[model samples]
Target: MNPYEIKELSPTGVLAEMGVEQGDLLLSINGRSVVDELDIRFLGGEEEILVEIQKPDGEIWELEIEKESDEPLGLHCDGGTLGIRRCRNNCVFCFIDQMPPGMRDTLYIKDDDERLSFLQGNYVTLTNLSEALKRRIVDYHIMPINISIHTTDPELRCKMLGNRFAGSILEDLAFFSEHHIQMNGQIVMCPGYNDGEALKKTLEDVMAFYPWLQSLSVVPVGLSSYREGLPALYPVDAQKAAETLDIIREAQDKMLAQYGVRFVFPSDEFFLLAGQDLPGEDYYGDFSQLENGVGMMTDFKAGLRDALAGRTPKSKGSHRFGIITGVLAKGFMEACAGAIEKVYPGADIGVLPIKNNHFGPSITVSGLVTGGDIVAQIPKENEIETYFIPENMVRYGTEDFLDDMTLGALSQALGAEVAIVPVRGDALAEAVAQRLIGG
Candidate 1:
């Protein structure tokens, strides 16, 4: 095994106080070989540890150290973060498969790394998890690992994932539960395959592992337009969305009665598709699955209401502003803007719904909306002073869109200042209020 090279040390940390410097290599902690951050985190949790390090002059030092259990040693090792494990399965509903060619190469990566699931809340299918990795997870006591469990039927799961080894999903889940590992789950519901009776059966089977499997989110399969040679998967239409919601509701009712907490939830897309109203805040129960689009609309609405309630109406001004969103959220966004206008009637906020020309019309989420589509769809004669876009439109930590369109380029093309706002309703209200009040 490769020794982790120490790149830096925190000045006040125990390692630095003990004369451990940069350029030294960490060999092991408490006789367990250190591989990545996870290893450091797990093994370094003890109040006392024997850390073995190799010096630059080839001197091996065995340091007996005692510190607070939660105190970090502060060794920034090279490649300390867990390396990504690429996905091995070819699921029929894989979004990467439906992506059009000639975009960023990183967008095509299919990551099924359990480490990512633990650290970043990414859902991973356990198909690629080796026995050693499983043991490591259990040994490390990694809790709340998110899983992508499409179904509980072994044969059906294998077929959906296109991997024969995928049949062990239930077994893997059972092992984690038996070890008292907390986990969250997801189901990408595809019509005609894992909907209706299949979905009901899957929910019932997984409910057996309740509390350990804390919550499950059922999201409709996202079908992009570029599926030319891929499997002929059906998108969840109005009828199908309703049916799926019904199944989820039944499971939730049972879970509420037995476990006193709703264990399953359907994404907001299902309610929108089925023409049903979003449930109030009580139904979401802390919004654990908010990242998965569960209760997003409800949360946004609640936040907006709270924000609006806290603020005094601004003086009337003629500040013409624009809000950009995907076609699916156009009406909802319009209503939000209208509510703001009621309090601050001076600002004229127009909601523009951009069609997903790049990913096809069926793909109608604001996060997937490209800057190219925004530029193409906006009317040239519009006199909007500033355009507000949800931060999700741009890639994380950068202003570039998925199509490589930089925020500066978009502003230049549109000939208007574009501001990226957080997806929360309060952020939108604050942005509009700030501009309206000339703050």
Candidate 2:
């Protein structure tokens, strides 16, 4: 029996539902020990499964249940292969490099795993891909790979990824295109590195492989306080953002005209930096790459509006909540705060823009915000009963922020109850409603 073993009391014929329960530790399936989700997924569905289980309270349970074809076993687990694949490339624009020290170790550890890409929609650079793994992806028929193609220029890509193997993006992309692998692409535009004419060239190169290339997202390179000693990477200013947008808009038009699709879209950050309005939801055809910051703003607005309409339009009591956000989202926060106020009259809602002190003023995204930034930003003596913080700012099971401050310490320092709201727009109003009613 393996250390992590679980039994299948009710077999649904699906790999996940083969017998593991809520508190069971999966030991093995058939004769093979379960190493990771990838291995399990690689193992494929079994007609007859030999499952072993270990209960939480020092008990072992084993059961062999046979079921019908393609039945899904209902089970979920957080542990993946027992370790995350940490990143090897130390790119100058890497946001993890900009993190202030002392936060959760998980937050600091960078992952470039394809398993995470398939399971959680996290992006991966094809540079670290081994031949066996590449072959496995083809064999496994893993559709829609999320690739970080920072630049089509091999020399520039090598510089951006900080790995010699990084130059293989075009070759790898060629393989994916040849194999008919559906994939979405990303380009982290640094001011002088891959923007302007360089960006246009990259878009054209990628579009040549369109249709197989589902979508492309161009996001601005993020800077943080930890940027010392890194290559002289520059932030995208308003002028640069506008230029990038213009270039992408032109490419989108061409792609739409010839390919019958707008294959490229600038992220919300670009428009925000340019002080421009977010594109309507219709502009984001299908939103297949929403996780890559493409169509995220549009989706967020739609979700928020839908949630707002579902609201009862009445608050049970007077409640004041302060929503903390980074400078990039000031306009968004203000607009959202306004809507919430209208729904709940006397609902004193304030959008607190926290200067990125931990990552310096250059950092703008909420996910990179540290507890220290929030601690310094939140008004200590404000009459607000609860400080609403977006869940994006902190990692799971850790007190530290993107910089290094603990949530517990921040809560203590502020002398107010802290509520961590998820990034989902639909959940935001529900959380606010809960905080108001003391639920």
Candidate 3:
């Protein structure tokens, strides 16, 4: 059994009280070998635990700890947080496989780790699960795991995922369902593959799990322009998007009548592509799949309405700012800008739609828009004093775009201060209000 090295210990934690210090190796918890933080969390949750630690000077310490069941041990371990398991299956519609070369190395990592699914809400295919891992999950009671269930048909799943063992997806789903494990599911709908009857079958099959399986999100496959030698795949066109929504609506009606809740939902992209108005907030039932682009537009619009209602109309001399977004969200951003302008009469907000040249024009989400495209596409004659870019445009925890362009570089090129605004409508409203009031 491999031991995890204790990187840092909380000053007031149980470990600190037990004389455990930094650089000590955490050997085991209650006789079970500690694999990662998850193991520590699951096994160390008991009211009484036997913790084994090894010192750098070859001293082994066995510390018996007694604490409240809900109290955390509060010790940070090195390389124990993200023991990320790499993906095994080569799915035909994998977005990472379609990424352009020579970008950030982390962009290409294919993670199908269930640990990530539980920790970060990343959807994982069950193709990589071993019996030991399954036992760990069941024993640990890792509730509410997100699963990428593209299809339920055994043969079809194997073909789509390019994994011979992928046919066991239904069995995996059954295993979790039988064990009373709570889960959320995702289906990446490929145009001609799983869009029609296959999607219906998948939905029907998964619906058997009901409240335990919970909600499922059906998002269209993202096809990038870099798929040269890869399998030929078609984008979900306007017609197909409409057809897919019809199928989902039919399933939703059935599920609502049977279960009092719509168990399945189509993403916002489907509605945008189908040229249909977004559904109201009541349809989303807590916006569980907001990160998956389901009901995002409706939620944003609702938030903006509430935010605008709370603000007092103010006129601080005429101040202009640009709202930078991707081509697909141009109209949406324009509408948002119009609402902000109404609240702050002195604010002139122009919506600038930057074409996604780096990942090809087909990829239209604002989150995927590269900084290189923004610098190249912004009009040279633009007189905007500042630009409000969505926080998603930059990588998490940093102000750098996918193309490695720094926010400072963008500000310098455009001759304007760039402000990173959160994706929420209230945040945008607050940002513009502060800027207007300050100037």
Best by TM-score: 3
Q: For each candidate, how many residue pairs have backbone atoms clashing (under 3 Å)?
A: 0, 15, 0
The C-alpha stretches of model 1 lying farther than 4 A from their native spots are: 80-82, 310-312
- TM-score on alpha carbons, each prediction: 0.96, 0.83, 0.96
Off by over 4 Å in 3: 80-82, 310-312
- What is the C-alpha local distance difference test score of each model? 0.90, 0.77, 0.90
Best candidate (score: lDDT): 1
On lDDT, who's better, 2 or 3?
Answer: 3
Q: Which residue pairs in model 3 clash with each other?
A: none
Per-residue lDDT tens digits of candidate 2, residues 76-194? 44453266777889786888887667765766778998878888888899777789779878976787889999899988888878987788788888898899998889889988888
Arrange candidates by TM-score, descending.
Answer: 3, 1, 2
RMSD score of candidate 2 (Å): 5.1
User: Would you give me the overall lDDT of model 2?
Assistant: 0.77
Ranking by lDDT: 1, 3, 2
What is the model-wide C-alpha lDDT for candidate 1?
Answer: 0.90
Cα deviation at 160, candidate 2, in Å, is 2.1
